[model samples]
Target: MVFIRATQSSSDIACIAVAPLSIQPFGVEPTDFDAFWTQQKQTLAQIPINPRLTLLNTLPSGAKVFLLELDNIDNRKVYAYLSVPAGTGPFPAVISLPAFGDAPVQPEPLIMTDFAERCNSINLYISAHNAPPNLPDPNAYKPDDLSKKDGFYARTMIMAGIRAIDYLSTRPDFNGSLGVSGMSQGGGWTIQLAGLDKRISAAMPINPAFCEQDGWRFERASGFPNYVLVGRNLNVDSNKTLTNMRYYDAVHFMKRYRGALMFQVGYEDDVTPAATQLAAYNKYRGNSTLLTMRERGHTYPFDEYFLGRYAFFEQHLIGFKNPFNFKAKFLADAGNDRTVKDTAVLEPQFLVNNEKNKVSNIQWAKIEGTGNVGFQTENGKTVARFSQKGKYLLRVSADFDYKLADPSVASYYTLTDFVTLDVGESSNIDVCDSDKEAPNFSNCPQNIALTTMGTSALANWTPPTVADNCGTPSVSSNFLPSQSFPIGATKVIYRATDSKQNTAECSFSVIVTKGDSSTPPSKNDLAISLTSVVTTPRPHSFTTFKVKINNKSARTFTDIKIQIPFPSGIVTGGAATSTLGEWKEWCSNNDQCFTWLIPQLLKNDEAIL
Candidate 1:
């Protein structure tokens, strides 16, 4: 049923709306953004985890520190300081990133060994650069071709961080859980590593750098490594450099993350500004906490606020809890009020502040007016059936159970939220009364225009992920990927429908155009390839054709149309399945003839099917 919270007197109840702060993103991301990073990780995976560790020293708290090195992408090396607890135990791991431009040898007393000892976990304090600590070389990354995406220095640093995580996971003493943290440049790395790598279940990025690198487009201050002046060093085209830097922008990454994030931003800090980091926090749908220290600027918070990070990690990584105050709250939201028929389907959510803590069980009870109310779990949701048509108040409670290191210590919390349901006589609107919210669609593809290779271009895109408060939503699309889009503009609509029949839709346009052949395709503009495979049998033979179209022209091509003859074996007048183009048969000199329509494709997209 729809949840309606009971209210008090008119004088007591007040509603206020405040506009949220957001850092609007600018610039362009490559069409192959996700694919590019996936390829980089794959490249890293191909290289072996040639790890070497040397004992450095041991703290009084029985924490041993060691110097570690590992092989990264392209046979490059990554250096770090590894710290572990004294026990012969398998512990959760954390890979700490370093500050920008300054590669110090010691990652210790700062946050490495201290964190390991406090949480009793393994700590791999790593450097962002290829060279070892204490040796700060500006040219460690060979930042000459910084104007290009693939050749950017930030990409290399991220790859090195990936290698560090790879090395830590291989240790026998390392537990399955892993995390990342950093300050300034390292803070930016922390967010990037956590967002880029799913292995990191928890992250603490403090005054992070490299976020919203292009915020200067609107004359606004950006996070660390502000690319405004950095662009001059590029000494290249400003537009091209802006496009290239988008790949390294931290804001783009956090938008897709949903894990536990311990993010901090400074109010007065000139680098990694408060607005930028808060913008990142707002974009992420996760268990996250943002601490905006008033006087803090590009540095660690005071001991009181700083110590909370350790407690946060302890609760998340080590399953230990002193206080469950890490900015997030244990919540049990019963949702809005509803008037339904006899059966009421309720989808109550149970969320915990720390990952280590578990939601043991959820109990639904009728606290007020009710007549023989029965409860049952259907498809993982609580359903209530009332015998009589009356108003009933329900309290759905969830327990946040903590797993303690010491069994003797007691740790647990219960959170409950209320919802009211009105039961009417049996009717067809049973599902409607229970659900009133529509599914939300995210990651919807941006509108794209494509240059037609033949009659049509095979346009493909990753479907958007949906979220609904009710239940698992089923998605439908107007266009099937198997079919081809003909010339001109085609709107691809994707719809998501929940179990209750509530629906939502999102769409993007695919425009196709024929280009002018008079002006030859630039060297970096177009790439088109075609391949055919055939099979012959005693009775019949079949040929399969595949064509790939890529548009990196940075501008649309218009004017000329090109078409390859449709395959001949199919039944005429029926349908000849071509994944890449439309089949329009014409009455020509022969039995039949067909030509594919060409259209203008987008600047940076490619299509295979």
Candidate 2:
């Protein structure tokens, strides 16, 4: 539903339209990175406690699943199913854990299989040993199995995953990058192992269960069952347990750990809750990405979502490129122009250049309205995640209606500005208004005037100190070498607003050039490489060998001229050269063959003879 809020008096009326979620969506623009992150932290402060869950799963390749048992450092045997892939060499591996269930019923064998195929890594599953293990000590698997204080399950299992990596290192085929993943309770442990174990290069935890647990009373029957079981065994107070669990919580642990992580969440899910998942996410300051489902439940869009997750781990963790790294394009709403609403979509390429020395992630926010908003991959197809509040287009489209009613009648309201994701500090852009018309500057002055006064290679320039009615004016420059100006983009785009609130833009380029009169070469370690070629008759007059000097005083420089001094016959002149390009000179050789003439030079000017 959309409405327009208008201020009207007899002769004139102004309208600002209100649109539903379908036409306008809310999100932080890239300029809001700091604010958004700050908000996330503030939210975390409100909910201080964390939750818990226990998970178990099968690791496999049907060829032959074996009950492989291993002992931890404490010598307690831990049971696991090891599934070796069909490859010849040592394969990369991932230890899989399933969401909490009392029994290892329908073990998520398929996901483990996918792990092998997708990641080309070995899969090891540590089953949730619900029943008591046949042990010498009755306390091992009892109702209050506090065998080793806070129990050995956490440390032992994490070590088991590390051991798998060690075992992988033994095989000649292993590449040595370990990735860990799990969902629900599994997600919690995956986080734990990833943080505590330095071996894990990548980790993905989906719909995790260990964050902000003040509300989820899992001690009750219908609550998250895995939390209940863990609470019962560990004698933990589920409500106040999170504060003590901080040492064990993956979220807190990540602060001390650094590496790659991928988090997934369901916006509509109350189970692990998107906000709580984000709480864990916000705690992580390392390299990571989040994939969230807006209208989905706790049961994620596993096939497509997990497939993407595996692909991400394979590329970043395993250093593998996708076979279908193709290009596709789509259009999105930039708002309306004429009868057609202006739109913008990602350029039709699935991949952009991987930024040098920077971490980047691509995300699409849902936009509501008649025209649809979503991300458009390089492939021409559109993926729409259903929404009850409004319609969404994964990317901008061409078929959107251009005709808008009255002075302003928008179908949706934009809550947050679109983030401009770019490299470095240049990622900030302006908040655009849909109803406003673009400034008309097709006939403005095209000439650009730029000048520099310092010895520094015109590194960069701040926009001209200028302002307009809107307050201060701002602009950006695209710098290039002098030779590349204009064509190479030595231009600046200036944006200004008038007293009447009218905006105008102008562009100009500087005609840059190299400085005149090259600075002479210096005489550093300038020993005679070879002797002089003096024509007989005009014997090079060995006159006053005073060091020729210049007036360029920028920085102090030492110059030495080692000359093959000649007294009489075969006259020769010593030339000056420099390893550090600076001012220098050539003078007559004096007395001895090794008589060295050296002089210190300053910046900008040079010496000669």
Candidate 3:
């Protein structure tokens, strides 16, 4: 549940009730799921696996890097960068998938080098869709008619992964063990590929997308490719869309996957909600582990998360002991099952129980709100008091003294708690107008006093200043003072602003009557004239024009607006360059016009445009 309240100050305050993770099945395996995939693999097999390899400059003197391509189900081609160790009869392999969107999937020479020399494994980083391996082109591939089962891009992309595995099998240095890993859309593909292929030995999917298709129906976050279920992308045939999507849903795929699975989830991820990820994870009937990052939204800390993956794969693929075993606990007075008042005192604590590692450092952060509460460790207890009202995520991160076996051994753990603080009614403000009188052509009241109630309320005017036939007038303060006005009436508005940026306003009109000979004129006494510089002006041809404006009034004027219209078919070139004013172009009804705002024009003053 979420509640939003509009205040008299800044933006509305929001409080969200974090939902508990539970498996609510919304996907049903298609009746022809196995049959469809069986036919897909057969179709891919018929197309000769015309594998093409282009060797690039080898790095580190111990590995060879090559660009690999293979034909998939469609006429499209799949590309990847394959790095193989120097001396190897048959080496273990891992297939890295690309993320969603138009991000380039270039070969990472450093990453491939580490995988080949350090891990003693062949690494193949594959690109999804018909995307080129070296550069990203947003218009490379457009999804087909999603209403039909065979028209979707997921079908072809999934086939590409299957065909990649087939190409890896043909490698002279390929070992029997295989693994898949990716994040977001790539994560979804990893799980789907593992489920479809029984040869997969291990899988790690980080914040995977394209799961729980029906999540939007319950107001929960849906994965990428969720567009097919709502808005303009929604299929005309809802029933067929639902059935076809289930065939590609990750939850259905996880149910059949038997490989060792490790999943990473971010609790604050609106892209693929933790609930949806949990739904898929709970459905898996295999050996699996989940790493939850409480405050992360749509992404994970790459260094720590990848270290854990390296340890997992090292143990399973290389037959290593995986010595990295770090554990941490973060606790707060505000538990998951309860909500405290806005002014409640929060007591946070961090504990680490690792005999092999010592706690090196600790840090805390308030993810939301305008409170001045700062974390402090007093007597071995981490505590802070929150005084503001809003939603906040309190996070505590701890680093261990011991490092992992990978490039960086310093292992870290982070924990977070969601909190909401509700305060009383917001600050408010009120404003009133001041009455005044002034002789024609003479200055009126310059300032007015305002009556306001609330915290940090300020007075101001909407227009700030006004102009009439008599002269331009402005207020000195929040209260409107007597100012020069024309014979007619002029409206003056006064406003009040509160600390929270809330505003209230009131307006009054000033009327000026005819006066003696000493009184000023009631209208702006100015003359403007325009002339074409060219003697013969032709249609659709460019021509220069000269404009002159002069002020003949007794009083000075500022911020004067001058407008000039041009005939159609005569486009403007270059700039109208003004001698003493700012020029701006205006258009209406196929006609072009130019306006100049003269900053100041004293009596008998002239400006050229």
- Model 1 is weakest, by summed lDDT over 10 consecutive residues, at 1-10
Candidate 1 residue lDDT tens string, 1-609: 011222321122121112223234554556878988899899999988888878878888788888788888756788878888888768888777777766456554555676567667787777767666756766665763656778777777898888888877777887778777888888888878877888888888888887877778866667778765677776777777677777787887776665577666665565676666655655564444445454445676454235656665764775422333444444456767889888888887766653432465566666666465656642226788776788887766555543323333233344455678898864433333466678889899887666654577656577787877555799998886535677899999999998778899989998877655566777678777766554343445544454566778766543324444544765334344433335455534544444443344556755442
Candidate 3, 515-608: lDDT as tens digits: 3335433446788888776769675566677888887765444457877776665676466667675887773443477778875555566888
TM-score, predicted candidate 1 vs. hidden true structure: 0.52
Q: For residue 466, what is the lDDT in candidate 1?
A: 87
Q: Which portions of model 3 miss their true places by more than 4 Å?
A: 1-21, 138-141, 229-231, 319-609
lDDT of 3 at 190: 91
CA shift of 601, model 2, Å: 89
- Alpha-carbon RMSD to native, per candidate: 23.5, 27.6, 17.3
Top model by lDDT, which number? Answer: 1
What lDDT is reached at residue 51 by model 2?
Answer: 18
lDDT of 3 at 247: 77
lDDT of 3 at 573: 49
